[model samples]
Target: MLRKGLILAAFGLAFVAGPAFASAGPKEPRQASWSFEGPFGKFDQAQVQRGYKVYREVCAACHSMSLLSFRNLGQKSGPFYDDKYPNPNDNPYVKSIAKDYQVNDIDSETGDVVQRTATSADTFPSPFANEAAARASNGGALPPDLSVMIKARPQGAQYVYSILTGYQAPPAGLEVPPNQYYNPYMPGDVSAFYKGKGHVPVGGFIAMAPPLEADKVTFDDGTKSTLDQQAKDVVAFLAWASEPKQTERKQFGVAAMIYLLIFAGLLWVSYRRIWRNVAH
Candidate 1:
């Protein structure tokens, strides 16, 4: 009888503790629609442009995309590509964009560092002078580079979209630490901060507060700037920045597949014609 009672107590304890651990992980990321989902799908150029606007106006304040150059924005199938300009550096739009920002350079004649207007050939400059400066400005959290961020995280595009749009009031009985905001999409264990015996919490703490606001940026194309729209567009841009050649790669793959199929068919036909008379 005592053995049975002890067994029952163990099961009861497991049942009680299970709920707490169950909600310890972040909620599954919300699915977001993207234009470039399937192999043949292409990026929406307009959407990508809008996404750049979001990054320039908001994300650029912290994150740096050092991998990209203004010239890349005017390359073939790029965001601001103009067919007339095969050389991206010569593209007027790219030049204009580069002119808006300043880059550090040393004067050829004098050895002093000087800030000069960026050119299409120059890579992006870091927002902070150094890593330590970056950390100090952002409350000890170094803002990550946005370049290729989509590839770095699992379900990255959707993850970004959810985080931007998923901020909500923290659940009751959960104590969020100072300088942190709760986000259901962020991965973390919340049981320690959760006071309830029922379920711990469904999300983790994030250092970044909600970055998107309605009408935060006025779109040049006149798309209504909702919170959801901003999130979707910026995610799209990051996805593109992660792999600008994705569309071209997909196109090449399709063409290669077609060519291979035709070659295989011709080979089969040749084999039948050559061996038909000798076959039993």
Candidate 2:
């Protein structure tokens, strides 16, 4: 009888505590120190191009984005959504720019353009392509698809920005505590994003391997940009990448809020009259 009572009490306590823990919204994602609000403020073509280079050169070895089309790079979905390339039938930029810009890999034997075309049958090409290959390349961390990453995780854009710039060394005498991850800016054990397996592919607060480095890539104006800047641009790119319809959503959300506020005011006025003299 005593055991039963104890079990019931334990269950009750668990039930009571569950919500408090669950509702504690995860740590704030790293926000790039940009001087603006909303996703549109961070859009920059140069930044996106640099970020694409970073992803291709360093982070692409492990992650695969099966969903994104190669043409998505310069399509209406890109940062410059105002104008699309003329021929969807043929990739003009790819053929023309190959001599100057080696943005993608060209197959030596078959002459295939790397990272081209989004097809139903083919999984998105990995920044690396295979699991063993990526792990061997990334020191055991597997980077995952960035395509839907902004939408998949909580506070996705902020998180992406945070993780990209989250690298830091732990204090001299303190070994990292168990189950607690390290993030330069974020506190606790959140790895960036995980690949399919129980692996900490990349992301969370303290990922083991670092994908982006400060000043590794530069802008056209001869300024060496920091990793934080690159990360911010990429986050903005990804945010836009996922939601081309973000402007519409915001407009609708504002309209909805206004409608609800008006409705609530009307309800209050109606309730006041309905119970005017009935208050005891």
TM-score of each: 0.93, 0.55
RMSD of model 1 against the true structure:
2.0
* Model 1 lDDT-worst window of ten: 20-29
Error of 1 at 193 (Å): 1.0
Candidate 2, residues 1-280: lDDT per residue as tens digits? Answer: 9999999999999877554333222345655454224633434555555556665555555566556544555544343333545442245543332223323557789999764433322333555546777767655656567778889877777777877676665433334544345554444432322212232222224434556677766655565777776677666666655664555566677789999999999999999999999966
The lDDT values for all models are: 0.89, 0.56
Clashing pairs in 1: none
Backbone clashes for every candidate come to 0, 14
lDDT of 1 by residue, 159-228 (tens): 8888889999899988999888999889988878888668778889888878999999999999999999
Candidate 1 residue 61 C-alpha distance from true site, Å: 0.2
Candidate 2 achieves a global lDDT of 0.56
The regions of model 1 sitting more than 4 angstroms off are 1-11, 21-23, 107-112
